[model samples]
Target chain A: MRIRCPLCGDRDSREFTCMGHETYMHRPAGEGWGPAWDSYLHLRDNPAGVTRDLWYHGAGCTAWLLVERDTTTHDILRVELASDAKRGNA
Target chain B: MVKLVEKTPAEGLLPLEINGISLTELVPAAITSLMPFDGQEAAASALLSSLLGMECPHPNRSTGRDGARAVWVGRGQIFVVGKAVDASVARHAALTDQSDAWAVFSLQGHGVEDVLARLTPLDLNRAVFKRGHAARSLLGHMSAVILRTGENTFEIMVFRSMARTAVHELETAMRAVAARDALR
Candidate 1:
């Protein structure tokens, strides 16, 4: 698989390491051992359709990317810098 | 106490020639990593441009003459080579000395592109990755920054610790390409 990095252009999947879902980026704050924290740490939805996930470009630009891909067809729908996604700019 | 001496990353491992391809270690005067602060991109670029006497580099591009150049590393990042960066630019960006952190080599020959093709996946056709274009990609199993300095020359940089591995990989590729070309 090839991922087109927003900063480095297209690169092979060997350069990237998948880091689970995009929600893994958001951590619950002001927590003192609660279900919200537990779910955030352990819960994951294995949807078969479209899903957004985070990938680290460890070998190339080292930029974190939020990739929207379809699990059924393995088609990449969209890719943006994770920082831009976090800032709600992408 | 005993005194310690300074040695470059690829001090004795390079300056190798296999067939027509030659790999020579390049010890630039200085190498500084520059990253502009938010909202200071233009200011930082202007300062660096004036200092290097070249336009500020854009993403995936480098600018300047030999002995003084800037190679874009990634988004908002560049490495100033060959000259000591001016302190005046510090107000616009963060500068970190990387002269000792990387091993740089100049690979030149008629079939330089064929040697790199065995390592990186990026398209390196002359028309596409023309001179002054830069890219951070994999060279064998090691991460590397590759720049096209001339039609038949390329500058490749890898982590200082991977100097041996980088040289070994390049040598292997050079010999393979040379042998293949001889057959043709």
Candidate 2:
């Protein structure tokens, strides 16, 4: 697998670490405290198809990435900086 | 101001010649980590250009002028190496003292890329990965900054605490390549 880091360009997968789902983008800091906290802390969805998730470029650029990838086929559809995506959405 | 006595992290392994390649410790006269303050790209660019007398290369690339070189080492960060007249370049950017944070070494010879390919996930093929290229990658579990300083030379920087291990891993890879070459 390969990821094109915004800063580092295309790099091998070993340079990165899968963080978790992108749903973590919605924080419990808002009014959805209890259930969101439980879901953030405990519950995890194990879907077998394409999903948007977070990844940390631990060994490369050290950027947080939102990766849209297929869980079953292991094909990456897209990647973008989480910070940029958040800002764009806002 | 008083200055601490400088020591290269891999100084003890100076001139580590193996398999026709020489792994030598490097002590760049001035090594600094420069990061732009948030939303200060224009300001940072101006100051760095004035200080470096050259354009700051984008990430994954390196640029040099007047003996000073800058390599993008991380997101929004660059590691400047080589000698400079003034040390006050920090006045322009968010500076972190990296003179002690990393151990710098230069591996030079014909098979240098072969040795690095064993550790770097980034392809070291000469066709694409040539001089003025920089990358952050893992070298045997240690996060490293790899820079192609010349046609036959690569400068590697690993965290100071892991300098010894980094040297060992590099040497082991060099030896392995040599052994394989001998059998051929």
Candidate 3:
């Protein structure tokens, strides 16, 4: 697939890095350490279908992105910043 | 040929281009922008290692500044600036330059940090993302590389297809800040 960048113009997808599924779980600061640590380190929901993800332009300026794409066909629906999207909204 | 101004002052926007590339010469060094590794940290690191002909460690993070004057940014990411980048180095990497698929933009000015904060989740606090540090993070859904070129300027690299979208987002934020400043 052809990937695009804001500054460098259109480059091949190889120049970009794929950061899978943008979903993240922030550990509750007040909670006990064990559960939070486990969730932070080992828990991840690998689902199919359309999902949001993160990517980095390793060869470029190294920008991170939040991308919504189809896991089945690798079709990208949308891309944005993780911070721009409210937490848990993905 | 059109005459390109090396340094031109825009009312609300800072000149971010340096000889056409989104880079600038800076002192003390800083990480103006970043690209999030997400989950491909390992793969990226390995690729860099092969290209650099050195053991880049797992999930490499590069600092923008050289030794002593260096600072560290996020995990599993590297900062490219100064001698770190040769401009032509991209040709050496395994990745193909689909330059047509991406667009490059430069960011400068005192408010550059504030503009980045609106689009990114990573802390832009100088104490955290100080000079010589670089991180990999997301910016408004586009995969990008944010390089700190100076204290007030940054080099933002994004895909060409998303150039207009990213620029619009940046300009909108910048204009809002300028409007707020005007009120003050």
Candidate 4:
């Protein structure tokens, strides 16, 4: 599989590490430890298609990527800098 | 000033100069890692350009005269190749010294691409990855900055701790390529 890196262009999948879903990134920050921490750590839904995911470009660029991909076809729909995407959303 | 000695990053194996390729260990006089401060990319680029006497290279590119060169490492980051300049030593940037953080190796000669192909998944086509281009890619199981300095010359910079392993992997590929060529 090939992933289009925002900085390095399309590169092979070997250079990247999929860091799970974007849900973890957007977990609510609150006053309690139990519920928030549990949801953050354990309650992750594994969707089948068009999922927003996080991947680390470990070997190239070394940037975190927010990737929208189709889990069924292993097709990448879109990729953006995680920092930029997160900030814009925030 | 304390005197400095040069040492090659080898996995205790002797350096090779066979099958039209030679692996030479290099010690650049300086290796400063420059990252532009947020919103200071233009200013950072200008400073490096003035110092380098050329436009600062953009992503996956490199520019400079032999002794003074700049290789782009990633977005907002560059490694100035010259005398060791301190982090923040240049204006409009956050800097850090990486002179000792990496082990530099020069892989030169014909059939170089064959060896690299055995390791990295990236395209090493002369048309695509021409001289003066750099890429951070996997070299064996470790990550490395692969810079093409000449038509048949490449510089591989890997972390110092992984230097021994990187050299071993390259040496193995070199030998394999050589053997294959001999058969051909």
TM-score of chain B of 1: 0.96
Off by over 4 Å in 2: B1-6, B65-67, B84-92
Which sections of candidate 1 miss by over 4 Å? B1-3
What lDDT tens digits, residue by residue, belong to model 4 across residues B60-81?
9988856777888887788887
Q: Give candidate 4 misplaced runs (Cα > 4 Å).
A: A33-38, B1-14, B86-90
Docking class of 3: incorrect
* Pairs that collide, model 1: none
Q: Which of candidates 1 and 3 is the stronger one according to TM-score? A: 1
Look at candidate 1 and tell me the lDDT of residue B37: 92
Model 3 C-alpha lDDT versus the unseen true structure? 0.50
For each candidate, the DockQ is: 0.71, 0.88, 0.04, 0.80
What lDDT score goes with residue B7 in model 3? 31
Which candidate tops TM-score?
Answer: 1
Better candidate number, 1 or 4, judged by lDDT: 1
List TM-scores for all candidates, in order. Answer: 0.95, 0.90, 0.41, 0.90
State the weakest 10-residue window (summed lDDT) of model 3 chain B: B25-34
| Candidate 3 lDDT, A1-90, residue by residue in tens | 644444333445665788665545243467567876777667777778887767776654455766777778887777655555654464
Candidate 1 residues A22-58, lDDT tens each? 8887888896999988988899999999999999998
lDDT, residue A45, candidate 3: 77
| Each model's chain A TM-score | 0.93, 0.87, 0.67, 0.89
lDDT of 3 at A88: 47
Tell me, by DockQ, which candidate is best: 2
